[model samples]
Target: MKTLINFAVILFFAIAFNGIAYSNDECSFNGIDDVLYFQENSISNLREITVEACVKVNSFSARKSGANEIWQFIIFKKNQLDHFNEGFAIYLDEKNERFATSVASAKGIQAVIVDKKHSVELGRWYRLRMSANSKEIKFFVDGVLVKSAPTGFPLDFDSEELFIGGRTKILKDKDFEGRFCGSIKNIKIWSKVLDEDD
Candidate 1:
């Protein structure tokens, strides 16, 4: 009996360490969306996802242009926004630049801010996801569709080193200048497209 318990514990750790697929009973990665997933309960009162889970992201579809762009909650480098060069972006503009979408503007949200610290509805627990598909880039907040990027967005990513809550400094000379402050969890990623229902 003791051996059985030990085996079970070892198996659990092994699977987790190897990034095993989740059981059908649990949430699976959505391929149609083809986006990054980050959830946190402490920050939004739902689930808490650590920012360290996703550090490097170059290509995302929030495909928007102009003063307003899509806003996908991501755990990017905190200091990346200090100079507003290019930190982990949700709604990309052309190649790999994340821009503010109109949806955020219409909702009265800037969607993009360069600072050492920022907070939203603390204790609400939020789930943020973003991805790039054949059509356009997409973004979701709390599992609810928030916005999409402008049509005809190029599907090209330049960065490679991906980090949770941190963005790469490839497109621009900007780096994270602030300490990422948030909870991140349940990180699942794939190199394929995700379905809407996924």
Candidate 2:
């Protein structure tokens, strides 16, 4: 992991100004409609990847779908319309009060969902980490390993645009409701699968 961190190429990516605000050393998102966009070229084509973020969720959206599906995205990059596609995402399952991470392929969405034991609470900060490769996907909360699952799929995806805090350009509509309401900071991404030691 150390060697990969040192030698592998890292893309810091662009952060476009949106409704989000940087205050007290973190970017705060209004649950209504706040999002940050990343440049396409900087975050595309990864075989193995690791993503980490420090977050404090203020509140989830009050609205719920007919099916009672509620999702609050932390990091998302995929076809907005389809779930079974080429991409990966990390999001909060608002209905279940847990964090979920998944990678998509033609086979379907392969996910590792954190158990109810690590439920996300309001106004508290959490260090969330996810690492994925062709063999497995692992998720962590703070420094503790939560869940690891076998997920054999290439991490590379077709979409170049990436989003943080919420799904891009879809917050106004209720059709794809996964806008996140939280404070996020110290986001790091690596184009290599990081180990537990990292």
Candidate 3:
């Protein structure tokens, strides 16, 4: 009877170990050619927005070599035809090893804020959050407010696509060449800015 009980315990341990080893909770990007996009009809025309993600960066280096600064985008939605046009984006700066977010209005006004105080470490998962409204924009890391600033105008973009992990077109400078090299999961988006306490 004791031998049978020991076998059952070992069986349970094996199942649990395999479950964790093959977990598929996060989406991994190759930092090259791996991208997820949604049509504007599915997600667009937001007066205010909040984006949240659980991200673990594998690397911040660009695929191409000549760019001055490397940018790895986690979520990018902007005009496909125009570079740096009206839209919103959340990305990491390779040089600074920090998170940055930007919002643009249809009228060409733009606002950007970076988490200057916090530098993210590679292979560490972070709960990155950005909330933007007509009045202001806020950036949070791991539930802590990192940066906030008054937005020049409410974010309004007529982009035809919403991209996760990468974009359709490469920027002129090509600094953001590699896209994002990381695992992202639990991405949440809201039409209304969520209260901090919530």
Candidate 4:
């Protein structure tokens, strides 16, 4: 009976290990040909991302067609920018034309980090955390909140055919123009706002 129990224990261990590995299936969209993608159909945060081709997107926002459809908390220090200066951006090309949302700075008010202030910091990771009901945008670098936007900004919209690694031409019409270049990862989407408390 002891030997039988030992065999059962080993079998259970094998099953458990496989289960852990299976749970690690995060959403992904990479390559030059790649265009757009949104993890959730509605506004939620498990983690969402908006990035370019040949890059990885780890975002809590879902890629969508309208404004604020994505979970990307963009930072625009200036109006016009060179490709190299083009940081993370998004826009809506349809009916709703909105731009310039409100955001706050945090942790030393660091310049475009994770990419270069605007672009995704090379070989770096970023996390965007927020609440469901509140308009709190927190930017995290390597799992740290370096900057943030309070609330009542450009405001979220409804659209699809979204763009990553840069904004679509229509976005330019709204004033958010720039094709971002770099790598991205870890798109988390949550049902409600997740912070130190939750």
Best by TM-score: 2
The digit string of per-residue lDDT tens for model 2 on 87-146 reads 677888777777778776545655555656348898999988888888888888888888
- Cα lDDT tens digits, model 4, 1-198, are 011011123323433533311122222222212222322224312122222112233332323333333223232221122222222232211112211222222212212222232344333434433221234444333344445554332223223322333344234334424332223333333433445333
Full-model lDDT for every candidate:
0.31, 0.67, 0.68, 0.29
The regions of model 4 sitting more than 4 angstroms off are 1-34, 38-40, 44-121, 126-135, 152-155, 169-176, 196-198
Tens digit per residue, CA lDDT, model 3, 1-198: 011011123323432533312135566776765666555443466778887778888887744322434777888777322545537788888778888888877666777888873488989999988888889888888888888889867677664767767655453454434468877776677776765555
TM-score of 4: 0.37
Q: For residue 172, what is the lDDT in candidate 3? A: 42
Candidate 4, run of 10 with poorest lDDT: 1-10
> Candidate 1, overall lDDT?
0.31
Model 1 poorest ten-residue lDDT run: 44-53
- TM-score of each predicted structure versus truth: 0.39, 0.81, 0.78, 0.37
TM-score quality measure for candidate 3 = 0.78
Clashes of each: 58, 0, 0, 49
